[model samples]
Target chain A: MSLSIRHSWFEATARQRLAGLLDPGSFCEFLPPAVAQPSPHLAQLDLPGAFDDGVVVGAGQLGSRQVLVAAQEGQFMGGAVGEIHGAKIVGLLRRAVAERPAAVLFLIDSGGVRLHEANAGLIAISEIMRAVLDARAAGVPVVALVGGSCGAFGGMGIVAKLCSAVVMSEEGRLALSGPEVIETVAGVEEFDAKDRALVWRVTGGKHRYLMDDCAALVDDDIAAFRRGSIELLDDWQETPDTLARLRAKQARLQGRLSAYGRCRDGLEIWAALGISEPERVPLLDCDELIALKEGLPT
Target chain B: MEKLEFKFPSQALLAAAPPALCGVVGSGNLEILVRSGVDRQICEISVNTSARGFGETWRAVLATFAASQAVGGTSIAINDMGATPAVVSLRLAQALADYRGGAQ
Candidate 1:
């Protein structure tokens, strides 16, 4: 394949993302399209089914380290977690526990559970969550990379948080209820779905990174993500999932709620955190934002 | 959804290589998964497309693809979501290239 100067992770397909993120000629896919393990439920609903569902799972080399990776195809069904899709992810996570890779890099770009296979999708997400925790508890780091067209939302948002660390790009959104879903259920007065700025301000990577929700934020390019992953892995010291760690995480979340529970927007939270020009936060690039965050007062 | 299958006589077999996949099953796009080990003189194609009543279009496209490319001894399965004939042809060529390139 011809090399592009900058390949946008958001623009690449699930398979393409795997090819770009891993080392050259390193990826070996699991349950690839030729296997034809499509969703058993979509056919009943008269929907077109993809051969490998909407997610690709496999083991590949990230730099010199062997890492198991799973990437959701956001273009198909919004990269929703259907029964088979969820199962593929869950299986990969479980395998991570057995064949402990250096890390499990989860490329999240889903809108959460596939609504067409509602109950099954929900069950699959739950299983995936457990499998992720199980892998982490077994001393494997599960890192999440969220920079895709669909972004990460709903149960997948919670899943991303459950990982050992999350790396995101400014365009990557991470949240529970998506902007459109919130607007549909709570009225536009509460959250305007059409206002892309507001949507990003609330759930985008900059906000998440400032809030200490994500471990790192990088540019939208695939190489940036690969570099970010390498940096994190280089600094990785396996911290077993212990009760004390859980308590500390809970306390940090509690502190965040106490500090900015009533904040109306991300700008308000940024101002409360002592940012001089919160309004300009959205315009800053990844390096500038990281510098800004570092310059903030504790 | 519609399913169409076609087989074309080919002049030469594709060079032995690993299976290859190309494209995405997104809006106005399709994915082609090509695997070897079919009849040495025939190229078999199967399509599962969202748009129904386009069997003739798919047949023509696959026929041209078989004629132009040395895709014999391969089975190509496509999952399409209303991709245009141009996209179908492009993905077919790309997939064949990837297969011949001997990379997965």
Candidate 2:
């Protein structure tokens, strides 16, 4: 099997990523461009609307088991969830409830809501969260893959956390608030958008994986992502230990708050996690980082 | 909040017909929706821009596009932010190119 070099998973468009992830010739796109169902809100706001509204969703086969997929086009408005785009995602998860796909994959690459349609976008995200929880209750695994330049922030961050598992590349950043927004609202002294190293140290995949915020952290390659996801499909139980898992996640989050609530620097958190030479973690290559993680004393 | 409409004369449809969308609505960017209209001899253009007092410029730019492309029986709708004339033309042409399933 030859890998496509034209649009590697890290650099591929939303459509290309979908094609690369799903089984060959088994992917079927819903709400195709020919349907031309753009956002009515954009028209009302005098903003141009996309026919598929930044999200491509549909059913596909993943190694024989049926699955549903939704990939966001980060190039489009940061892949923000507006009315139509959010509705499309919600619709897919809802369908998963009745259809009972083996799993649902969300290729998240959004900065959350579209400010132009803030109210509608917010409500749509809320609906999507509910749909995600409902699908999980129905025993369908929810997986989030974050790798695009936009990464995931705002409400989408919370949505990603609610998933059964998250697969992220070292390039992926998962945070509740973006660096620029933090700087603007909290002052540059609190967070500087210009400080790329600091930004990555705080929210990069390595940090999140070490903190247990994300499940798997892999290299910035589509093949690496593919291996990570297939491992989840094969290893993860269909019906997870929901109660125990929730409780464990709750404990981990509580530990974070208690341990780092007062810390201002990301290095402090890294040092507390027992990483030597904390500053170098951000500079380490993906393979080196993974090896270091593997070599950690258990 | 400004809306402008224009009609152009042509006999052949664009490379792509109606119901095709190209572009995104970003900070200073815009989106274009191309639809096939009933009439075969007229190409319709409508624009709604966030910027004000650019009606004449829009008309000039769009008129030139209509004359050059000679797109017929198509209804083009645009949502613009503060995109310049150059960006606007590029987006319009890109929209048409994408509608034809060509490389962007």
Candidate 3:
């Protein structure tokens, strides 16, 4: 029998996502809620305390290969990263490099940092970004999965893009600043902040896929995302020349700069990639959508 | 955080298809994205605002546009930092014009 916590991570339970990602009965959540590893900064600010500080990082396995996993909690201040939260990510990424696990999977859904902690959150996120890049230098596969409605923005979005592979769902979105924030910074006349379809067009999974930023765009189920992650790991294992492949990947990005530099909108990219009907492209069912162009890597 | 809600009925009209858009995702800025389906029938709009309490007014502006224009089946998404009403309609219209080329 399993012991249930009084609180949950979000709409889906933490262990539930873990179970899907890891082999059956293989997950042992480290620093779990019941273990009482809450955020220390909360007390300093007179803010209500939280368990686990909204991030869960630990070691697990994908089939027989070992993997490091980190999942952020969206319920807690939209899963903002604070000092401890960002530290946990850095620590695990470092450990993952040392262990040379088959891969590292980060379940991200954050607004970047915890404002209550101010500079701590910002600094921590900065460290987290460096850690992700380090994981790449070490040749460990890093996969960032967007699993919540928060859609992973700000610093988190930038970090997520640097992963060796990105697996986002139909609902996943990635942006430097969210729609409302953009309207404020750029002026309402320059941009419209009230259009949901417009926002999703630039950031949603379909858009990311069309842009070559997302490795695989799956349905809205965790099982699908997990399955995609497993396959990505398997592909890396089969080749084992991850670094060489990625360099070629970056070279492709350099090559495409001219084409995408002048172009804007997901449809343009879709059309350039040979989706003859760019206007009808977004309306296509996932199955009907054309395969992505051969060479870009995120 | 001050939240403002209003509408710009295309200052003209607009639409999305595998849609396209422009602008920055920055503090105090907004991004315009849309999929203008080839349909000349309807434009479906859903604005998730940090500024609460303008649903009816939003509906009114939308109604005004719908009554005048026959835009249909296009999907739109907007992220607002606090844009005024006129800018809203103008950006949408500009997005429509730019995308008529199926590029940025």
Model 3, DockQ value?
A: 0.01
Q: List per-prediction Cα lDDT, in the order shown.
A: 0.90, 0.82, 0.67
Q: Largest DockQ belongs to which candidate? A: 1
- Quote the lDDT for A121 in model 2: 93
Query: For each model in turn, which proportion of the native inter-chain contacts is also found?
Result: 0.67, 0.52, 0.00
lDDT score for candidate 3 against the true structure: 0.67
Q: Considering the two chains of model 1, state its CAPRI-style docking category.
A: medium
Model 2 C-alpha lDDT versus the unseen true structure: 0.82
| lDDT of candidate 2 over A1-298, digit per residue (tens) | 3355534565666877877777787888888766656677877876556667889999997777788999998877789999889999999999999998899999999999999889989999999999999998889999999998899999999999888899998789999999999999999999998998788778889888777778888777666776778888888775645688879878978977998998776788878877888888888877777777776654
Report the candidate with higher TM-score, 1 versus 3: 1
Whichever of 1 and 2 has more DockQ, that candidate is 1
Ranking by lDDT: 1, 2, 3
Tell me the deviation in Å of residue B65 in model 1.
Answer: 1.5
Report how far off residue A266 is in candidate 2 (Å). Answer: 3.2
lDDT at A37, model 1 = 64
Predicted candidate 3 versus true structure: per-residue lDDT over A108-154, tens digit per residue: 88877678887988888888888988887788888988857677898
On residues B1-104, what C-alpha lDDT tens digit does candidate 1 reach at each position? 88788999876563767778888889999888888856898999888888999999898988998998777888888889999999998989898888888743
Residue B39, candidate 2: alpha-carbon lDDT = 75
